[model samples]
Target: MSNDSPKLTPRQQEIFELIQQAIATTGAPPTRAEIANQLGFRSANAAEEHLQALARKGVIELVGGTSRGIRLKAGTLRGLHETRRAPASAGKSRLGSLSGLTAGNLPLPGLEQLVLPLVGRVAAGHPILAQEHIEQSYAVEPSLFTRTPDYLLRVKGMSMRDAGILDGDLLAVARTREARNGQIVVARLGDEVTVKRFQRNAQGVTLLPENPDFEPILVGPDTPDFELEGLAVGLIRKDF
Candidate 1:
């Protein structure tokens, strides 16, 4: 270890190791929730406190306003690599070559980015864009989609399977009240949020599911709970 390296507690060391393991496996640091789950912490706040401690000790760097912003400092990074007792084969891990993964001190690209909140669940009576429903923010290139997205909502079911949308996919949505007749959209009915093909006529509005197993949702123009949240512009699917 370098002479300037700050001393770390045993728990801090364990957390640091877990962070590296997460980066090696997923190309990003684990979220506070993930770290809390792995370390048996009572809440994500506990993990956040430990991370603050690590940042103060100069072992790692944290970027403000970013959820997965943890980065191992260069001297600390090299020291950690040198202290590893694993076999040579283990050096082949992805962490060995993480160049270009980060821009500036951040662990992910910070340029040409559009940072939008990723919505998880919509509670009844709360607005769709309520702060409580935003799970995290994702930075993606605007050019990745045909239209720039206002937010990304996690797909909950396989109702749009025939449209090539599956559960666990991230549906990039453009905020708009008007959608073309055949456009895919994020529709809000009462407390339920759904992704489906939009069809509107003088009779009513219909949310058509692409899969045969699911039935269409018909909403009358007078329905107070029915609202058009956005148009589906892109999809992000992660491979395990």
Candidate 2:
């Protein structure tokens, strides 16, 4: 590790670690109020102040207009992990070669990239990952996701815009057949696959959209052609 790594105060480190814990546990960042409650802060304002400091230090990026808009910057995500290990591991470069699996988890150490198959559309009655379904591949940093992704799906619509997932975003996905309530998931109903929050109750599973302009999709547990494809592990926005 270079001396260039951003330094955090003891309190800032505590708050930052809390943020990482929330993401790892719930697949989302804790709200300011959640942070305050977790750390016994008198108010969310105190949490926000520390968040602002972390943002200024480039340890995280605070997105406006969303309660869970806290995003960890890519390169620095694993830097925290770096501090915990023995000093010998410091020789590992977080920006090492781009190789992990298809991208070749390259023989290097630290935070490495995983070359994930970029899935396009799902043809009815076919496996979601059938070779023909993949449009290309993307080398994504695993540290950016709470879990390593099995693939990258290009989001095609704006139904999830309010959740900060806009059209054309690459939604990193970890293959899974089940999801917790409120967790975003990639699901296929009939011949269409959509990304939405997973909700279940007496009425069955409802794929709730982030945008009110769109209607939630209902999937009976026994609904034919219905399948849970994967969980939304992370997101990548194209710079166009």
Candidate 3:
């Protein structure tokens, strides 16, 4: 940050660092409740107040109407993408010359690009990333995904159209067995695999679709089989 930029309080600095760490590890910003829980705040309102303060300081941009809509500014985002390995020799700097590149661009062929498998339809009782399920592989910019993804799954329907996740788009998936409320995920039920928002309640688990016409998939105690394949980390729209 520039010296001219507005300064932050100690608490704000702590919250800011927490945000960076969350995005770096989980590929998505933490929700207000998460921030409050992590920092010992009594409620999410305190976290919201602090977030507003941070926004005024120009370190983060918050989009309303979404729980995980917080965005790190460009300067801070670069810090999250920095590789953990030690620097190269004098002649082989990782951040090479930028004569034809813009600042914060990290699409260097060998170092910054991510080769991800593109998964097609999955067979019953088989792994999602099975060899037969992989249609092809694509070399994508690591920055294109919030978190480094394990594979790209081609969306099959408009169930998530309201979320801007359309049919034929590539859904970047980070393989995980767990998910928090309101986060979108790719889940498998019996022999079927579908993408939907994940919600856990005392009653049971609910797989919610973004479109109103589709009914939520409710998983109760007697459900035959339920498994969480992965979390939806990013999206690549082909039609756009």
Candidate 4:
């Protein structure tokens, strides 16, 4: 290690290792919620502060305007990899304890699973996956969904029951600004977030709920409040 490298405290080291392990296993850095959950922190802000410290110490770089934009230094990553390769048994034990994951839980080289943030309610006009909105995160197998979702939004209503989506279900959503007609999407109208089938024409856009009890929402072409957050790619319901 170079003298220029910042000294990491035990907690800082653990957070740094978690970030690296996340990138190694999931192909994406962990969100604040993920780190908090893994570390048993009651609030995600603790993880946020640690990340800021890491940045200040030159251990990790934080990208502005993105939630999971953490970057590990190339030299630090190489050093971490070398540490993992040091002794066969030590490497196994270290890998086994990363955020409580063992080698068996990690995906093979070509098969990377995704760790998606579970977004709760969105504060009006704020980004959907903003730090405050993320409740937690879950890992899903790559082969289990239609497409890779950027995050999971908790379903709130029976608006799409006819389409098998229910209240309290977890909706897997892929990030995209555009949604084709007839596709289910997570959309925003002012402060409200809703799941509905999308349709558009020269006149305007119509958000159609599958349940007849709910009326379709009409947005004129020039409406400034309407925004498409993402497309619904898959669904998950917890038995508990």
Task: Name the candidate that leads on lDDT.
Answer: 2
Provide the clash count, candidate 1: 0
Q: 2 or 3, which is superior by lDDT?
A: 2
Tens-digit per-residue lDDT, 1-240, candidate 3: 333446789899788778765654544567899999999999999999999999887767776655765766544433334432224322111111001112134334555678789999888889999999999876666653455689989889988765556678777788999998877889988878899888899999999987787999999988876889998766554422
Question: Tens digit of lDDT per residue, candidate 2, span 66-135?
Answer: 6667777654645544543448665232221111112232223544768889888889999999999999
lDDT of 1 by residue, 40-73 (tens): 9999999999999999998777655445556565
Report lDDT (CA) for all predictions. 0.70, 0.73, 0.70, 0.69
TM-score of each: 0.54, 0.78, 0.58, 0.54
* TM-score top scorer: 2
The reply for model 1, stretches above 4 Å from the true place, is: 1-111
What tens digits encode model 4's per-residue C-alpha lDDT throughout 1-240? Answer: 334567999899889878756544433467788899999998889999999999898757675544565666433533443455566524421221011121243332444568889998888878988999999887755443335679988889877765556678777788899977867788998888899888899888999987778999999967778889988765566545
Q: Which candidate, 1 or 2, would have the higher lDDT against the true structure?
A: 2
- Worst lDDT window (10 residues) for model 4? 93-102
Off by over 4 Å in 3: 1-111
- Candidate 3, backbone clash total: 0
**Which pairs of residues clash in candidate 1, taking residues 3 or more apart in a chain or in different chains?**
none
In model 1, the Cα lDDT at residue 142 comes to 50
